[model samples]
Target chain A: MNPSGLDKEIILNAAEEAIRRFGPSKTNITDIAKILKVSHAAIYRHYENKAVLLEAVTERWLSRVSRPLEPIMKENNDPEAKLRCYLKTLCQNKRSSVIEDPEMFENFAILTQNSKEALSTHVEQLFAQLEEIIRKGMETGVFETDDPREMAVTVFTATSRFHYPAFAKEWENPNIESLVNSVIDLILNGVKKRN
Target chain B: MNPSGLDKEIILNAAEEAIRRFGPSKTNITDIAKILKVSHAAIYRHYENKAVLLEAVTERWLSRVSRPLEPIMKENNDPEAKLRCYLKTLCQNKRSSVIEDPEMFENFAILTQNSKEALSTHVEQLFAQLEEIIRKGMETGVFETDDPREMAVTVFTATSRFHYPAFAKEWENPNIESLVNSVIDLILNGVKKRN
Candidate 1:
């Protein structure tokens, strides 16, 4: 019998929880199926194996988290505003309020390796979008950069500190907003103080 | 029979090679013994177990690599010069020229966790030394920072990108020196363009 739409969603949610608890290395299909109160075969019918199931879970999470960026990227007429919003979203999401689970972040390295084509496409799309914003900002004399792609990568990498596990304790401090703003200002205006 | 000094060194070297080749997860004592042309019991005499052998190997590697920093930290009077030199050394030694094995880099993460207390103490001492330099710079009105410890962490983290695997390919370019210099400049002088 074909699993219902709800069955797939339940299985995906169970898999996400299992992977988070055990990491990609230790997680198994049986563990996920048991968590869902379903048979392992039920999961195999919906998804081929644990790898594909984990991949689907990752794709689902990315879609959910990245959805808000679509409207911000599309509707904002000003490239600088769009870029600032994107950076803010990335930094601010470090807080508990914005992120429901921290474990979702761990799967990215494994997911990136296991599904290189899909992950690369998604990352390339993000870089391309950021590059477009940088190009527009340069044309408007808002951003000073000779190479937009390199600058985009630099910006992305700098902001990635928010997601790093090492920074989680520090991110809880009250001054996190100011710290994030300082980092953003350093990138946008350069760190050299204007005389 | 006790292994000779030469035999012990050979076993340790072979174990290092095996760990590098197979990674910590797959490496076995027998594999190391086979590589060294010795019985596995000889390795047990020297190391007690694989874990202890790995720890010794890691400690040996760190001691050899970190030896140069001692003289610079102790003899250098200028904090900035010491900091700059230390950072340059860190970036330069990302891959040990003497080892000629890329696998050593991958095996290091395993060793870092294997000897947490020793590694942590060593890192703490290094950070403390860096913090002193930062504090001295601030006192001399050469460095602009309210919190020397936080500033040290920021500098260390940002400069560490030079040693990251992701940046290894890009670092081979002739411009990497200038790129690292720019990052240092930004940390010390801020990034804003002067009028």
Candidate 2:
């Protein structure tokens, strides 16, 4: 035993770097141990297994993504603008993350590919944020009446092309901004109180 | 050279069956020849290369898909009905194709993955069909005014989740039909003429 004493934070960092370098399937706890200069047992103490470590890393990523949106969600701005900003920011965050480090993002994708429950939790958080804005709009007579939870899902699914990583290749197109704007307008017209 | 005389139709049939059995990458011209009881050179005589053969198979698949939609496009129904029917049929066609034999669909996906040009041609045909309906709607004042081509594209992109093969896993959800109906409601609201 090296007995050098490794923390979970340090192990998480090494795991992320290792995934970036080797892709998901090739990355392993043993590799992270090598990077951390500790025994595999030491790493295992912090993260019970590969799946556990992956979930932790994914949770960290989701929290980082959620941080910027909290202000937009809590702000007293018009619900329409808040909803628009929330979606635009969400799309931008995903697109930029994919573009900034494509290889790393690809590895992350493989790691999360089968973790349906983990990904679903992240989406549930998004739905909750959207539902809040939707509910407020419905209450203030600014938007049409509908189930806030359902409307939130419809809006999110409607703009899937812009925000979904599967469609990220299309994000680089010059017309993507207008496409997002057009979809937003379509959704607004759908949701707003129409006479 | 086993010049037993193979036609393009025969070769395409063999190639498609081969792809379905072995997937795209694992499938090769030699394997197709083995299936056909002929020399690879005999198969090559009809198609210049594997890329050419794959494109032929894709074109055939796309044309088969396009056949059912032609009647809906040509029908003199209201533009709104036409648009709704067109999009619904498109989504159903895709979902069924994915569901009926997922393995074949998966193999087809691999064959067509990198052939962006081939797939774009199919989408262009879909767009053209959609644009026609939108133009008719605009002329009759039944729908809101916009560039028909642009609006057609927007509608197609917005409804991508139901139709795109990437989300095939979600197709099994029992609520997918209702989700689709809600989206159609949203699109109609977005496009219909307002007072």
Candidate 3:
């Protein structure tokens, strides 16, 4: 990459780090530029403002995190297996993303307000993608849900909250795998005891 | 009530509102004093500092919210009923407390230190109160569970998150009640399909 391109990359990485440390509200362009050993004007050349830079960082973060799900979502034929994989992927990876990068998550929240249309568009796309997998499962008779959209919402909500216990103020047991399994089973098989 | 006692009540309410609006970091004693139409020095007479004022506000918030459960919890003879009532109480009441009172809950995060010790102390007290109900249900073979503590945590975490959709983002569904009921059912009965 050219020197300018390298500088931009460095600036973006430092911005992400700053967001992680000070949260979205506290992080500023000067802070990021200072950490990057570059002028604030140089950052402006690459990005319009702090908002734009934050949005780009959030986009990068989501793309990186969501990338792993694409393969399993595309290739997997078994709905149950796919659902299991999705939960496991979240349990093993997504949880760490929040715990490891709180600033990134907070930055994402702040950027969402700045660019509501863009944020909503991306959110709608994710929800649609999730709903498609759920609809497929319902069509295959692997899932017995009456409302796939609602079920999708419920499962996604429960799984997302599982990752961030700080916000929710509740946590599963240390046996995370079994906790994941039990929650997945509850969703898959409607929690009514079997004969 | 004595005039001094009434002034204390007024001060605490104002403090709670200030904390909720500005968050713990931004809220100051001057703001609370102004809101209560009292001298800033008067606040210092009752509480040493903002931190002390915040702790008192949080303790008051907890006591207010937890008070409603006391009757349902104390009166309930059955473990399953007690657990169900507890879950219902949390789902119905905890939402407003969290939503309307951000500082109160945020202060909880500070008090709890996001550790099992704080969590266990609260959960253990709740569990002990529900122990007889759970034990009686287990003895009668109504509830089939080996570890009530783990089950209590699971129920608490799931039900608590079920109500707070904004935090999770995935729970923006319209039919949240049904969704909550489904989770409750799954927990009460195991999720395996019945014959």
Candidate 4:
């Protein structure tokens, strides 16, 4: 997207790949440029600095976390089942990111520790997706709620331990899957309408 | 306790005071010894080193987090009210620890992040207290559950966002009290007996 005639995707891919292979501390703009066969200045045209570029990478990663659940939101399945799948997939996405590349994940955590603007946007996007699912459930007359957005926030915050980075270390417990399931069941039961 | 003419509690109190004043990095056994009017050698005679003393300080602090809830467990209030009081006190304990002394808390978090032996014991203590409340509720026929311990874990994990240090930044939201109440209602509704 910059004047170098290279797609922003290519530059991001190279940056991520370089960071993964070399780790964030050793990876620099020049290394990213080398991987993409473009001038570091070309990368600069898009990102004002390395910090901005890293934030973009973090933003992209955070944006993709809930992608697998998006299909569930649109599916013609029972909203309750859809809710379970949505939460499970959301938790899985976070767990797999930690398992697959812990170094890069830690790098992301450190780089964005003090600045949460990008993270706030990512969380809002997640909230909107969750809100849509709750709204659909309400429309189906299966959920009992006057405020889908508030219900969404309640459910999201409730299940945070299973997905949040702070509790990532607890994810490896043998009871983790069962724990998430129990919480999901409680949420579903709580939200179900009474005749 | 080790010919220092000082009780272990006195030493701990002095150590906590020194850490609060100088911060953790600047705090050392000699500083604590100075505070307690004991020789650095006398302090070493009781604690093997600064690390042991620091861990002990952390352990003592963790032990006290649930103290205020002890009376609620023995109260004759409705089980549901008891549950709410238990959770609220637990949360307030954590929140106050942050608000009253943000520096000390960050120090505690950093010191214990890698070594969770002390924290694991602390979490188990919390789980035990929660299990007691749920068991009483089940006995009163107010709660519906085949396994109180599991239910305890489920509810605790669900509401973790409101209490866990990772989401500490979000606790200041004006809606936090209402949000926590909403989640508590969802949990109570989910686990209440249908009869």
Query: For all the predictions, what are the DockQ values?
Result: 0.18, 0.71, 0.29, 0.73
**Per-residue C-alpha lDDT of model 1 across residues B25-115, encoded as one tens digit per residue:** 7888999877777677777877888778887777776666667777877774766676778777876776443236555665765576678
Model 1, stretches more than 4 Å misplaced? A1-58, A70-85, A91-109, A128-143, A164-193, B1-56, B68-88, B96-99, B132-142, B160-195
For model 3, the DockQ equals 0.29
Docking class of 3: acceptable
lDDT of each: 0.66, 0.83, 0.63, 0.81
Task: Name the runs in model 3 displaced over 4 angstroms.
Answer: A1-11, A17-46, A98-126, A165-178, A191-195, B1-63, B70-85, B98-119, B127-148, B162-182, B185-193
Between candidates 3 and 4, which one is better according to DockQ?
4
- As for DockQ, the candidate ahead, 1 or 4, is 4
Better of 2 and 3 by lDDT: 2
Q: Per-residue alpha-carbon lDDT of model 2 for B64-131, expressed as tens digits?
A: 77778999987999999998898888888888898898998777776667677888999999999988
Tell me the TM-score of chain B in each candidate.
0.75, 0.94, 0.70, 0.88
Window of ten residues with lowest summed lDDT in model 4 chain A: A106-115
Tens-place lDDT digits, model 4, residues B87-185: 878877888888887878877766566448887888888888888888888888988887888988898899898777777777778888898888988
Worst 10 residues of 1 chain B by lDDT: B186-195
- Residue A82 shift from truth in candidate 1, angstroms: 7.3
Task: Quote the positional error of residue A120 for candidate 2 in Å.
Answer: 1.1
Best-first order by TM-score: 2, 4, 3, 1
RMSD of 2: 2.4
Off by over 4 Å in 4: A1-5, A21-28, A111-115, B1-4, B21-27, B48-51
Off by over 4 Å in 2: A1-6, B1-6, B39-42
* lDDT by residue for model 3 (A1-195), tens: 233654556777888788777887788998987776767787898889987887777666666656777787887577777777876775566566655655465566565556656655655655666677778877776555566676666666555556443442233335666766656654555411143
Instruction: Point to the candidate with the largest TM-score.
Output: 2
- The B-chain TM-score of model 1 reads 0.75
